[model samples]
Each structure stands twice: as structure tokens, then as C-alpha cells.
Target: MAAQASGDLSLVGISKEFETFTAVHPLDLEVPAGSFFALLGPSGCGKTTTLRMVAGLEEPTTGKILIGDQDITDTKAFRRNVNTVFQSYALFPHMTVLENVAFGLKRRGDKDAVAKAKESLELVQLGAVAKKKPAQLSGGMQQRVALARAIVNRPDVLLLDEPLGALDLKLRRQMQIELKRIQSEVGLTFIHVTHDQEEAMTMADSIAVMNAGRIEQQGDPASLYEHPKSVFVANFLGQSNLLRASIEGPGAEGTVMVSSHGQRLEADASHIPEGAREIWLGVRPEKLRLGEGGGPNRLHGVVADASFTGVATQYLVRLPWDQEITVVQQNDGSARALEGENVTVSWASHHGFVLDAAEPADAGLGHEDG
Candidate 1:
């Protein structure tokens, strides 16, 4: 798989509407040349719709799209230099893998279409199965054929809409790495759409988190995970215990004193408004230390439940206000606490993130509008 020269992609105030329902809100995004970017959200978050508009498959109700400085908003799907690997793989069952891969090149009337198709099949490591129909291949192999078909034309951008959605868990994990490798080899700007947070975190250089047709946050995975901007982002990105807190007074480093479950805790809040009295504090389960801890934020709780995973143990601790906080502990030689045991949970002050208390717009699940 020879890498294609990189190209830039831009979406400016793009929006899509079907009758009275707005499937995608006006949004702007810029994907740098050769970057592996992901649009991540639960189903119905408009990630797919946004991807469709960028691929020229769906006309935006407003705004413009650009590929390598070329205005492509009004361009037809076939005219644009972009290819999409749909969720369904969409391979022609009757056509052999070789012919299916060669289909796009045949339409372009390329003289070396058949040879190029063979080369692409080899790139995807599917040349050995070239003579077999899609029905004869495994789901992963079929997906590879679909990928070969799309890349055989060597488009400027490759849009992957849940390309690994059909595979089983183990296969999906394997395909994530494969997809990343292929994207790197192709050097095409890969814009992937997926609802799986772990998938997005593993493969993307940057992620755009969408909610209810609007982008909630966009950043590198580390930044998004460490400093989520809203409650929705904090909860959606991974498991986190959200605790209701009331700001009390000024504290160290421009932080404010907050009270939660009758315990006073200090946290940095230079970014938060001074007079704002109430906020939701987000603490990752892994950040919480169990038993008598020596951290900045400490609290007493009773173990409500415990579950043992292969590598770690999960404990649900009940607080004074009936709030449940989850804690994850590595499975080491240390004795694991049983359910109904009294325990103290603690974490560093820096580990907590304060989010505004508000219900985000409902983002539905999976290709509803499309």
C-alpha cells in the first residue's frame, strides 16, 4: 500500500436539515493533511451525517466544504476526490474480490485498472482471496475488500463510517490496529466516524465529540480525557463519578472550597466563575484511591458492591448523600475488599474536573436520519 500524498480538508459552518428536523447543526472543522481524525459520538449525534456532507453524499443545508483548497460543497459525490467505506461493507456478493476492487477503476476507464486492482488486493493482503466471492470470505476479509475497492481509485480523503462495526469484539480490536496501519501507509487524510470511545481513543490523532447535531468538544484524546469541557463529554468519554458540590469560599491557586456529601474539598477553579455557587465535579474511577488514602481529596464511604475483573477490581462506594462513587483498583497482592465493607476513597485535587450542571441535548443512536 503506497501512501498517497496528503491533502487538507475543511468544513465551514456545515449544516443539514430534513424538513423540520436538523440532522446536523452548523459546524466548522479543519483536518490537516495526512491526519487521522475521528468524529466520535453515540448514535444520533450527527457524526455520520457530518461525514456524509464532507464526502459529498449529502448536500448541506448551509455552509461549504473544501478539500485541498478546492470548494467541494456543491460538487457531486462522484466528482469529488473522496472515497467512503460504508458500515455495511457493501461489497457485491456475486463479484469476485478482484473484480469488486477493480469496479471503481473500471468506471474511470483506466487502462491498467485490472493490474491496479490486483496491486490493491495485495496491499490489503487479500490477493490470495481475489478469486473468491465476498460470501466466501470472513467479515474482516470482506471489509478489507471494501477498503481495497475504495482505495484503488486513490482518493484525496478516505471517509470510514463505522468500518469495523460488523465485526466481533476481538476482530474489531484487531481491525482497529489494521485500519491505523493502512491509514498510515496510504498517507491519505483518514476521517473516521465511530461511536466507540475506545476505538476513537486508540486510532485518532484528534477527536471531535458530537452531541445532538452539534460538536461538544474537539481535541487530542489526552486533552479531551483530562479536561472535558462539559458534563456530557466527561461522562461520555469514559467512566467517571459525577458528584454534586457547592462552592464555599476562596482557596489555594485560585481554587474554591466545595462541599460534597458533607465533606469539604478543594479544587482548582480559575476558569470557573467566582460567584457561581454550584457545579458538578467529575472524578475518574481509576483516580480514586481505596482504603485509608494519603491524597488531597479524601472521603469515607461504605462499599455497596464489588466486582472482580481479570486485571482490576471495581467497587461501588455509597456516600453520605446516597451518591455512588465507583473506584477501580489494580489486582495486586493487596486484599480485595468485600461488598458491604466500610472504606475510605480519596484522590488528588487535580484529578477532579468541574462541569456546569445542565442536561445536554439528546443525541440519538446509529444512522437514524440516514
Candidate 2:
């Protein structure tokens, strides 16, 4: 096993290419040391390729990989102090939990292998399962075992490749918390790769949203969700009701006035693309309220569909322009609208965002649901 080294992961112009096409484009990124960072994108978006390059499994076609100030571009996979926990877990069925976790440490002839493995298992809350075989454990437990195996090595960076993907939703959410806790306790930098938006936002301290083998945006989860600079980032990170609008210049309190579907709407001026007159007025489903709720921005629409999802009611409002927008209202026993009723959707000026209309509004739609 490799020894520990505390260092930020820097990918300077890092890229990957295959015989047919480039898997990853020239990329520059810095994953802060001891932060939970996520490479979030759809399948085949080159996130996995980028992760493999950092683990020294895939040689980069260009640029260098560094841990802190040390250049590890030429290092071998086994020599780099980076460990990967994959979705498959891959624990040996024949070995006990402790044996599985201790295998790597023992292979390196570490004298405290058992003790280290025990501590790692306990860190993952699996200390009691040390004597149990892999087959006796649940899927989530198996995932934890795999994590313990990697953590025992004390790698400077822990790479999780959809490690919780195999479990059910409830279990997966549970593991997200566990993973974050383990990372906090261990204080090791974690680079997680997954396509699930919620998974990345829930566990990551910072997120890099990737598309077409390139970084579209990178920031804290709330910043990316609230102030998305690109249409793809706005739509892909969360559900957005983007309506084509023509900017009517500035508004009061630094907001932008825009006209859409014969109605005037206001958006955050700071979110408006610089010098972009034509824009898409964007609002989240949760940001909209049914009926005229005293917000500056309002749209008259027919309730095309409504679905009750326990605590919230999701309404699909069909605007006069024949476009459908979603509105999620809390079930607080208020007078909710029916499917066929005509209503006005209203939201605060600050709740709306603006994106460049030059790009397709539907961009990142298919990838998000898949």
C-alpha cells in the first residue's frame, strides 16, 4: 500500500484520447485537499475517464497530474497514493470482512494490518461485522467493506466511482451521509464520480458539472443551482422552466426586465449574461406559486396536469404560448388549483434567473432524466 500524502489534486491540462476519439478534452481543475468534490455528469461524459487518469489507471494524452507540488504524472497506478472504491465493491466472498479489509495492508507486510483494518471497519461502522463473510452482508454493508479496504491504505485522495449506485434509494441516501461522515472523520480528500445529481449535491462540498467531455461549471452546490451561468447548467442541475424572452433593459433594484409571451417578467440582473439582449427567463418549479401571489413576475396559464406527491403537489401549467411549465406547491391545505383551471403563476423577481438565449433551452434535458 502507498503511504499518505496531504495534497490538493491538480489536473493541469489533463486529457485522454482513444484511437477513435478523445475521451476527455484538455482540462484544468483543482480539487481542494480534504474536500468532498464530485465529478457529476451523464454516462459516457468522460467523468469516469478523468477519474481513472487521476488514479494512474489511464495515462493522459496531455498535461500533468500533481499531488500538492509533487508531479505524479509518471507514477504507476499501484504506486500513487490514490485508492478507488468502485460500484461493484469486489470484496472476496471467501474472506471474512476483516480479512478483506486487511488484505491490502497484509500484502504490503504491514505489522499492524489487523489493527488498522479493525479501525477502518469501525470508521465505516462495520467493526461488528469483522468476523462475518462478505456473503452474509447486505449490499450497503458490502459497499462499506470496500470503502474500509481503501481507507485502511490511508491514501491522500479517495476516489469513489458510484460506490453507492448498487443500493436502493433509501439505502443510497443513508450511505451518502455515512460517506460524508467518514470523510470528515478521516479528513481525506474525496473525489466522487456519479451521474445522479442529488447524490453529488448531497455529499459534495464542491461540484464540477461536466458535459461533452468538458467542464460546464464548477462551484458550491447552491451557487451552481441558484446562479447557473449556462443554460445546460441551469437545466441539468435542476428542473427549470425556461421561457424565451427579449430583454427590455434594466429594472429596479438591479433586476432585468424582459418580455415573454406578451407578458413582462423580471430576472436577476447579475445572472443575465453580459451584453445578451435575447435571453431565456428561468425559474425553478419550487420557486413558482399558483395563483397571483403578489410577486412582480406573473404568467397566465392553464393547469395542464397536476400530480400529488405526498407533501408536495406538482402542477404542469400550460402557458398561453402553448408551453408547459412546472410548479411545485406545498400541501399546506391551501386552495390548490385543479387540472383544467386557468391560473396565474407568480414568483418573486429574485427567484427568476436569466440565461443566454443563444443556446438551446432544451439542452441537458435528456441527459438529466436518463
Candidate 3:
């Protein structure tokens, strides 16, 4: 079977409301053709609602959804050139894997359904198990079957709503790689909705972090991780040590001075958010290095706790201001800190990220006034 021509997806001022409750605020978003896009957020943050709107399963309260040049907001679910894979595999219990994969094509009156299904099964590495029933397959195999069933139809866009949620941790990780590989080989536009940060980061070409019916940040995973604009994004996407500090204006050689608890630190001014005064200086735990001296961006603290993980050592340091900061260093077999010893934490100026101190107006502020 020929592959479906991929199309870019567009949501223009889309919003959803349930009587007095608003699930999604007015939003505009775009997914490029043949790109792996992820809508990442916690539960009730409207990621699923937005996906359902794209799938035509939930009607948008306002605005239009488009696929390339065609308006699909009001189109019926089955009439649109799109397919959805839910968390549940939803395979037919009694039907063989091949039959289940070919069912959609058969219903559409395609004469070569079985042959196409076999090809899809091979794409997902389940061609040998085509004769097995859903009950006979493992959770991972059943998921591959489900994916085969969806991709067999060769839809213009594929919507995945936490399809790997049912798999175990190891299986989930494996499927994440599998799914990305399949998507790349097929060149399909895949819009994935997931609450798992790791899953989104691992699979998506680009990600939009949603919270309280709004997008807190959107970019490639590295960009978002290295420079988060808001506190919600800094804390949500990964573990960040956010220190309350006031910008003491510009420093020498393109650096900005930040004062926290009488200690002055310098950060790359280019990375600081525009118009931010009192800011939260963010540094990933893994970016911090432990030593015993004052430096450009340094903090002196006492080692409160330390844990030895296989890949690295995790340290909890108590600062003079009665606050704790976490640090992670690679297990390079160097001098380690004792629990009661005082230590200095240091990082390069370029590694620091500055975020606005004030929370977003709608962040945990509830729904907008009607």
C-alpha cells in the first residue's frame, strides 16, 4: 500500500468548555508535516482535550482546526484522514493479529487488505506473530499489534494518546525507541499526547509543555531544558535548583550579577529572560560541580546527605540561608564529600538559566473569569 501524504496540523484559537469549567483556553498551535510533535502536561491540563479536538472526537468550543489547507474542525471522526491509538490496545479478542490489522482496510472495501496488513505488521516487527490472537500476545506485542492496526490504514496524521501507558518501565522504554524508529521510517505526522516528561523528551521532535490550559513553553527538548522562561517550566520539565535572587545588573564580560543571600553570582546575560528583575536562578543538578573554593558562580554549603547511584553521586547541600540544594556528579572515582563536611558548589556562567520569579497569572490561578 502507498503511504498517506503527510500534512501539517494547525489549531487556530481553539478552546473547550464544559458548562462552567474550561478544559482548554484559546490557543494557536502548529505541527509541521511529518514531524513528531508532543503535547506534554499533567492530568487535567488539557493535553488530551486538545488531541481529541484534533481527532474530531471532541468539538471545539471556538476556532478552527486545519490539516494543511483543509478545515477539519467540524469534520466527522471517521471521515477525516486521521487515526488514533489510545492507551488501551483495543485489539479484537478473538481475531488474529493479521485480521485485526486488516479489519480497517477491509471495512473501507480495499481489495488488497491482507497484503497491506502484513507489510504494516513487518514495520512493527510483528509479522511473524500475525496469526496470534490478542490474548496470546504479551503486553508489548499487543501494543505493536495495535500500532500495526493503526498504521496499516496509512492515515495522513496519527494521534497517540499515551499508547505506551500500559507497558512496564522496560517495555515502555523499548517501545519509545521502536515508535520513533517506525515514525521516522514511515515519515508520518505523529501528534503524541503524554504526561510523562521522559517519554515526550525521548520521542518528540518538538514539545509543548502545557499547564492550566496554557502552553508554558514550546521548543526542542534541549532548548526548553537549557533555557526555561517560567518557573513552572523550569520545575516541571526536569529537576532544577531554583535559587531566589535579585539581578544586581550587568557584570564584567557579558555577564549579569545576581545576589542571593549576600552571595554574588554571575550568569551569562544572554540567557536571562527579558525585563526580569527579581529572578529565580536555575541550574540543573547535574550541571553543578563540587569543589572547595570561591569561583564565578559558587555556593558554599554543608553536605547534608549523599547517595551513591551507579552512574553518579547525588548530594544534598544545606546552604547558609536554611535552604537545601541538590547536586549530581558523575561517578568518576574522585575525592568524595563526607556527610558533615562543608563543600563548595560551582558551575560555569553559561550553564545557568534565569526564570521569572513571579508565577504566570494563570499558573495554578484557576480558570479565567467567564
- Model 2, residue pairs in steric clash: none
lDDT of 1 at 271: 43
RMSD (Å) per prediction: 2.8, 1.9, 3.3
Question: What ranking emerges by lDDT with the best candidate at the front?
Answer: 2, 3, 1
TM-score of each: 0.92, 0.97, 0.95
lDDT tens readout by residue for model 1, 1-370: 5665445898999999999789998999999888899999878789999999988888999999988778999889988888999879888878999999998788878999999999988888898998999999999999999999988888888899999988999999998998888888877788999988999999999999998899999999989998888777777788778777888887887677898868898777754533557777778899899965746788888999999998999999998778888999999878998898888898877888877655432212223321
The residue-by-residue lDDT of candidate 3 on 263-296, one tens digit each, is 9999889988788898888899988989833246
Better of 2 and 3 by TM-score: 2
How much lDDT does each candidate structure score?
0.85, 0.91, 0.88
Those runs of model 3 whose alpha carbons end farther than 4 Å from true positions after fitting are 1-4, 292-295, 360-370
What is the RMSD, in Å, between candidate 3 and the native fold over all Cα? 3.3
Best by TM-score: 2
Q: After superposition, how far is residue 235 of candidate 3 from its true place, in Å?
A: 0.9
- Residue 302 accuracy (lDDT) in model 1: 91
